[model samples]
Target: MVFDFTISKQGNYAIISMNGNLIEKGQAIALLEKAEELTKEGCSQWIIDLEKLIYMNSSGLNTLIQLLTKARVAGGEAVLFNMNKKINELILITKLHTLFKVAGSKSEAVEILGL
Candidate 1:
Protein backbone atom coordinates (compact mmCIF):
# COMPACT_ATOMS: atom_id res chain seq x y z
CA MET A 1 0.00 0.00 0.00
CA VAL A 2 1.05 3.56 -0.62
CA PHE A 3 1.92 5.76 2.31
CA ASP A 4 -0.53 8.45 3.30
CA PHE A 5 -1.61 10.58 6.22
CA THR A 6 -4.65 12.46 7.53
CA ILE A 7 -4.69 15.24 10.08
CA SER A 8 -7.45 16.26 12.42
CA LYS A 9 -7.78 18.74 15.22
CA GLN A 10 -8.83 17.90 18.74
CA GLY A 11 -8.77 20.78 21.12
CA ASN A 12 -5.15 22.02 21.10
CA TYR A 13 -3.66 18.94 19.49
CA ALA A 14 -3.17 18.12 15.83
CA ILE A 15 -3.82 14.43 15.46
CA ILE A 16 -1.99 12.84 12.53
CA SER A 17 -3.11 9.41 11.44
CA MET A 18 -0.51 7.69 9.25
CA ASN A 19 -0.77 4.52 7.21
CA GLY A 20 1.22 2.15 4.97
CA ASN A 21 4.99 1.82 4.72
CA LEU A 22 6.93 4.92 5.73
CA ILE A 23 10.17 3.88 4.11
CA GLU A 24 10.72 6.53 1.48
CA LYS A 25 12.15 10.02 1.83
CA GLY A 26 9.21 11.49 -0.08
CA GLN A 27 6.72 10.01 2.33
CA ALA A 28 8.70 11.27 5.27
CA ILE A 29 8.90 14.68 3.67
CA ALA A 30 5.15 14.72 3.16
CA LEU A 31 4.64 14.07 6.84
CA LEU A 32 7.11 16.79 7.78
CA GLU A 33 5.41 19.24 5.46
CA LYS A 34 2.07 18.55 7.08
CA ALA A 35 3.56 19.09 10.52
CA GLU A 36 5.13 22.32 9.36
CA GLU A 37 1.78 23.47 8.03
CA LEU A 38 0.18 22.67 11.33
CA THR A 39 2.94 24.55 13.12
CA LYS A 40 2.27 27.58 11.02
CA GLU A 41 -1.44 27.20 11.83
CA GLY A 42 -0.66 27.66 15.55
CA CYS A 43 -0.71 24.06 16.56
CA SER A 44 2.19 22.91 18.70
CA GLN A 45 0.72 20.01 20.54
CA TRP A 46 0.52 16.91 18.36
CA ILE A 47 -0.67 13.36 18.53
CA ILE A 48 0.73 10.94 15.95
CA ASP A 49 -1.63 8.02 15.80
CA LEU A 50 0.31 5.17 14.31
CA GLU A 51 -2.18 2.37 14.73
CA LYS A 52 -2.55 1.98 10.99
CA LEU A 53 1.11 2.17 10.09
CA ILE A 54 2.42 -1.15 8.88
CA TYR A 55 6.09 -0.37 8.17
CA MET A 56 8.66 2.24 9.00
CA ASN A 57 12.29 2.79 8.13
CA SER A 58 15.06 5.01 9.44
CA SER A 59 13.66 7.87 7.43
CA GLY A 60 10.40 7.54 9.28
CA LEU A 61 12.29 7.72 12.56
CA ASN A 62 14.01 10.86 11.39
CA THR A 63 10.66 12.37 10.41
CA LEU A 64 9.30 11.72 13.86
CA ILE A 65 12.36 13.28 15.45
CA GLN A 66 11.93 16.32 13.28
CA LEU A 67 8.30 16.61 14.32
CA LEU A 68 9.21 16.42 18.00
CA THR A 69 11.90 19.02 17.55
CA LYS A 70 9.54 21.33 15.74
CA ALA A 71 6.94 21.03 18.47
CA ARG A 72 9.53 21.80 21.13
CA VAL A 73 10.71 24.81 19.19
CA ALA A 74 7.12 26.02 19.09
CA GLY A 75 6.90 25.61 22.86
CA GLY A 76 4.61 22.59 22.66
CA GLU A 77 4.91 18.83 22.80
CA ALA A 78 4.35 15.86 20.51
CA VAL A 79 3.29 12.41 21.62
CA LEU A 80 2.49 9.18 19.86
CA PHE A 81 -0.32 6.74 20.47
CA ASN A 82 -1.23 3.18 19.51
CA MET A 83 2.06 2.26 17.84
CA ASN A 84 2.41 -1.36 16.82
CA LYS A 85 4.93 -3.77 18.35
CA LYS A 86 7.42 -3.64 15.51
CA ILE A 87 7.47 0.12 15.47
CA ASN A 88 7.80 0.18 19.20
CA GLU A 89 10.77 -2.16 18.97
CA LEU A 90 12.44 0.01 16.38
CA ILE A 91 12.04 3.03 18.58
CA LEU A 92 13.48 1.23 21.53
CA ILE A 93 16.37 -0.18 19.52
CA THR A 94 17.18 3.26 18.27
CA LYS A 95 16.98 4.60 21.83
CA LEU A 96 14.34 7.03 20.68
CA HIS A 97 11.70 5.66 22.96
CA THR A 98 13.19 7.84 25.65
CA LEU A 99 12.71 10.93 23.55
CA PHE A 100 9.03 10.34 22.85
CA LYS A 101 6.01 10.30 25.07
CA VAL A 102 4.06 7.21 24.08
CA ALA A 103 0.60 6.24 25.16
CA GLY A 104 -1.92 3.52 24.67
CA SER A 105 -4.76 5.87 23.75
CA LYS A 106 -5.40 9.40 22.52
CA SER A 107 -6.63 10.54 25.90
CA GLU A 108 -3.58 8.99 27.52
CA ALA A 109 -1.25 10.76 25.13
CA VAL A 110 -2.94 14.09 25.80
CA GLU A 111 -2.61 13.53 29.51
CA ILE A 112 1.05 12.63 29.14
CA LEU A 113 1.74 15.79 27.24
CA GLY A 114 -0.53 17.71 29.62
CA LEU A 115 -2.20 19.32 26.64
Candidate 2:
Protein backbone atom coordinates (compact mmCIF):
# COMPACT_ATOMS: atom_id res chain seq x y z
CA MET A 1 0.00 0.00 0.00
CA VAL A 2 1.62 3.19 -1.18
CA PHE A 3 1.14 6.30 0.83
CA ASP A 4 -0.20 9.34 -0.97
CA PHE A 5 -0.59 12.96 0.08
CA THR A 6 -2.03 16.16 -1.31
CA ILE A 7 -1.12 19.60 -0.04
CA SER A 8 -3.10 22.80 -0.54
CA LYS A 9 -2.74 26.20 0.92
CA GLN A 10 -5.72 27.93 2.49
CA GLY A 11 -5.14 31.42 3.83
CA ASN A 12 -2.36 31.02 6.39
CA TYR A 13 -2.75 27.26 6.68
CA ALA A 14 -1.47 24.31 4.76
CA ILE A 15 -3.92 21.46 4.45
CA ILE A 16 -2.55 18.00 3.75
CA SER A 17 -4.87 15.15 2.93
CA MET A 18 -3.35 11.71 3.36
CA ASN A 19 -4.38 8.31 2.01
CA GLY A 20 -3.22 4.69 1.88
CA ASN A 21 -0.83 3.09 4.35
CA LEU A 22 1.83 5.25 5.98
CA ILE A 23 4.04 2.43 7.14
CA GLU A 24 7.11 2.64 4.99
CA LYS A 25 10.15 4.54 6.15
CA GLY A 26 10.34 6.37 2.83
CA GLN A 27 6.80 7.41 3.18
CA ALA A 28 7.51 8.84 6.60
CA ILE A 29 10.52 10.68 5.27
CA ALA A 30 8.49 12.08 2.45
CA LEU A 31 5.82 13.28 4.80
CA LEU A 32 8.32 14.94 7.08
CA GLU A 33 9.96 16.61 4.15
CA LYS A 34 6.68 17.97 2.94
CA ALA A 35 5.87 19.30 6.37
CA GLU A 36 9.23 20.93 6.55
CA GLU A 37 8.70 22.49 3.19
CA LEU A 38 5.40 23.88 4.27
CA THR A 39 6.98 25.27 7.38
CA LYS A 40 9.63 26.98 5.36
CA GLU A 41 6.97 28.41 3.12
CA GLY A 42 5.60 30.26 6.16
CA CYS A 43 2.69 27.95 6.67
CA SER A 44 2.47 27.96 10.43
CA GLN A 45 -1.00 26.50 10.70
CA TRP A 46 -1.68 23.03 9.35
CA ILE A 47 -4.55 20.62 8.96
CA ILE A 48 -3.72 16.98 8.33
CA ASP A 49 -6.79 15.15 7.10
CA LEU A 50 -6.46 11.44 7.71
CA GLU A 51 -9.89 10.26 6.68
CA LYS A 52 -8.49 8.09 3.93
CA LEU A 53 -5.55 6.63 5.76
CA ILE A 54 -5.95 2.88 6.01
CA TYR A 55 -3.05 1.71 8.21
CA MET A 56 -0.24 3.45 10.01
CA ASN A 57 2.70 1.90 11.79
CA SER A 58 4.85 3.29 14.57
CA SER A 59 6.93 5.22 12.10
CA GLY A 60 3.85 6.95 10.82
CA LEU A 61 2.94 7.97 14.34
CA ASN A 62 6.43 9.32 14.85
CA THR A 63 6.17 11.28 11.65
CA LEU A 64 3.06 13.02 12.92
CA ILE A 65 4.74 13.79 16.24
CA GLN A 66 7.66 15.27 14.41
CA LEU A 67 5.39 17.48 12.37
CA LEU A 68 3.54 18.63 15.45
CA THR A 69 6.78 19.37 17.22
CA LYS A 70 7.96 21.43 14.32
CA ALA A 71 4.77 23.38 14.28
CA ARG A 72 5.05 24.13 17.98
CA VAL A 73 8.67 25.15 17.61
CA ALA A 74 7.52 27.62 15.00
CA GLY A 75 4.87 28.92 17.36
CA GLY A 76 2.12 27.37 15.31
CA GLU A 77 -0.37 24.52 15.49
CA ALA A 78 -1.02 21.30 13.64
CA VAL A 79 -4.51 19.95 13.85
CA LEU A 80 -5.41 16.40 12.88
CA PHE A 81 -8.86 15.43 11.74
CA ASN A 82 -10.91 12.40 10.70
CA MET A 83 -8.59 9.87 12.29
CA ASN A 84 -9.67 6.26 12.14
CA LYS A 85 -10.29 4.19 15.25
CA LYS A 86 -6.98 2.36 15.16
CA ILE A 87 -4.95 5.53 14.96
CA ASN A 88 -6.96 7.15 17.72
CA GLU A 89 -6.44 4.10 19.94
CA LEU A 90 -2.72 4.17 19.36
CA ILE A 91 -2.59 7.85 20.29
CA LEU A 92 -4.56 7.21 23.45
CA ILE A 93 -2.40 4.26 24.43
CA THR A 94 0.73 6.25 23.91
CA LYS A 95 -0.70 9.11 25.95
CA LEU A 96 -0.08 11.39 23.01
CA HIS A 97 -3.68 12.45 22.80
CA THR A 98 -2.76 15.32 25.08
CA LEU A 99 0.04 16.41 22.83
CA PHE A 100 -2.03 16.58 19.67
CA LYS A 101 -4.89 18.83 18.72
CA VAL A 102 -7.66 16.72 17.28
CA ALA A 103 -10.84 17.77 15.52
CA GLY A 104 -13.88 15.88 14.35
CA SER A 105 -13.89 17.43 10.91
CA LYS A 106 -11.78 19.57 8.62
CA SER A 107 -14.05 22.55 9.13
CA GLU A 108 -13.65 22.21 12.86
CA ALA A 109 -9.93 22.05 12.53
CA VAL A 110 -9.97 25.18 10.45
CA GLU A 111 -12.07 26.85 13.06
CA ILE A 112 -9.65 25.77 15.76
CA LEU A 113 -6.83 27.30 13.79
CA GLY A 114 -8.90 30.47 13.53
CA LEU A 115 -8.82 30.34 9.79
Best candidate, TM-score-wise?
1
lDDT of 2 by residue, 1-106 (tens): 7899898998889888889998867787777888888888888799989999988988888888898998888879999999999988888898888989999998
Which portions of model 2 miss their true places by more than 4 Å? Answer: none
Q: Candidate 1, which ten residues in sequence have the lowest lDDT sum?
A: 25-34
**Once superposed on the true structure, which residue ranges of model 1 sit more than 4 Å away at CA?**
none
List TM-score per model, in order: 0.94, 0.93
Give the lDDT of residue 93 in candidate 1. 95
Q: Write the per-residue lDDT of candidate 1 for residues 2-113, one digit (tens) a residue.
A: 8899999887788989999888887777678878888898998998999999989998898889999999998889898889999999988999989998899988988887
Model 1 lDDT, residue 114, Cα: 82
